[model samples]
Target: MSLKRRSFLKGAAGGGAALATAAVVSAPAQARPNKVMPPQAVGLLYDSTLCVGCKACVAGCKEANDLPVDVSTPDALWDTPLDIGPKTFNVIKVYAEGTADTKDQEKNGFAFIKKSCMHCVDPSCVSVCPVTAMTKHPQTGIVEYNADACIGCRYCVASCPFGVPQSEFDTPTPKIMKCEMCKHRQAEGKIPMCAEVCPTGATIFGPIPALTEEINRRKAMKAGEANVFERRVIGSGDTHERPAAKYLDHVYGEKEVAGTQFRHMSAVSFTKLGYPELREQSYSSQSEGIQHSLYQGMIAPVVVLGGLVWAAKRASHIEDEHPEE
Candidate 1:
């Protein structure tokens, strides 16, 4: 009887060891490469130098989305949300130094940055969602969330590098919320509300390729050079003239995490504007690559299960041969 029990224990341990080995063997040698941008992808370009911190984009987003006002002030007289939240899809943040007298200077000046969904090409939220709650449009490359499919798991909230997805914790029926780039407006032959209402052409909406060209054009311009910036849509001819500020050489979201549809140009360093520095490869690509490699065709799990079943059968035969003395 003692020998039979030992045999069963050994069989179980051997099964577990086999399972671990199979899993390790199934794993790929390297993580998957980052996904490429969609062919017809559209996106936003935010020039921090042109932004006036007026919050017009915020108001326009709320109105276009039919979102309620988010009041953070004690008086509740104005909708002055400090950052992006459930009801606030977009907001402008200011970085200040010393007297904050200058606009784009980092030493004794202040600069404004727009905060919203980055709409990553390889979205971590889309990869982490257990249900198909978060999805990216293949054609437009817009990241969208479906409340009906959401299981309230908050995986998206945890996975987003930009902290864009916000959960409605205060409500009884909570839902995750984020920007969707005004898809409805686009269907109606209109542009994103924020871009349409931007008086300074700070935030412009257009195709990703065109926006990249525009970014390059901006980068080549000399500091204080007067330029005509397009507004609303890239080719709308609705233009505004302003002397360009000394822009940083780096363009945020161009290659970070493989790329994002929303790009930003700033005179002040992006790190100071609360943007996280990230590598070219996306988190989703690495994790999903390993997961898919292990589970492809259910090969690894089936192998492990088969080993366990064979061990269990051997243990049962041993028990039968030596009945419970």
Candidate 2:
């Protein structure tokens, strides 16, 4: 019998073919671009299996950005937010199932996922900014927003495919909030704070090339195998050895948004922590290409505007010549 996607009843996974054969025919991971960044601009690769869900990265991000806490309970002293929002640029959210003991397994496994600005390869926020308020740095590809140039239109908030930017709704003079990859600290030769303070080495900072190698090493191992996980940045000597959680054979942001600067690997199905089932081609990149092709140098629009002005003037002159008619 044919089975639906969410069910394990009868179709794809349960088809009567050899398991090896079916795996070979299953879809391949999306291809990413060879677009280059500067020598020093840094990013992170997070393995969900390595994370202990300690919330240290979230706290570190808040401290690094000098941002205030988004409190869920006014009566509580420790300001823990349930999700990313205007006051919180990063958050560690949890997903649970029955018993929730296994790390990456789908049936009853629980896992932690870190959420923040994806820093998209082709950012929708950058494309839709009317005044260049949201911009991609040439070297780092970090999307930064300037509030001075924004008209509070929330174009960026709406256009971002990852829904990263959030407006401060409670304040009178509100501003959109999001991660800028800690560029200010990066200028001082510091890595991103979350990566800096991650104790488990679940989050490591470096170029995409090096990060991919690290991820490959993990994928090569069998479940329950011992591996030394690096915390913070690679080559930093901060590491710990632990038995590997069963990886889900998927990397979250490796190809999402045409490859996010910050990549993710996890043991659990991403949907557990709210990752959307995705299209490989980035909507932001597609949207920008279409817009640029149509409006190159504004030459076409100028010619259309000139024709419109000439028609309006001619109509006015004809009306003056025969006022009565």
Instruction: Indicate which candidate wins on TM-score.
Output: 1
Q: Which residue pairs come into collision in candidate 1? A: none
lDDT of candidate 1?
A: 0.92
Q: What tens-digit string does per-residue lDDT give for candidate 2 at 1-325?
A: 3323443322232333334443344343233333444454457888777788888888889999999977788777786888788989999888888888876666787788888988776677877888998988877778898989888888888987677999999998888899988888888989899888888887788876788788888888888888788877877888788898767677887776566778788877777769887766766556666556545666545555555555545545555666665
lDDT values, one for every candidate: 0.92, 0.75
Off by over 4 Å in 2: 1-41, 74-76, 296-325
For model 1, the superposed segments whose C-alpha errors exceed 4 Å read 1-12, 27-29, 309-325
Total backbone collisions, model 2: 3
Q: What TM-score, to 2 decimals, does candidate 2 have? A: 0.78
User: Which stretch of 10 consecutive residues in model 1 shows the poorest summed lDDT?
Assistant: 1-10
Candidate 2 deviates by what RMSD? 15.2
- Tell me each candidate's TM-score: 0.90, 0.78
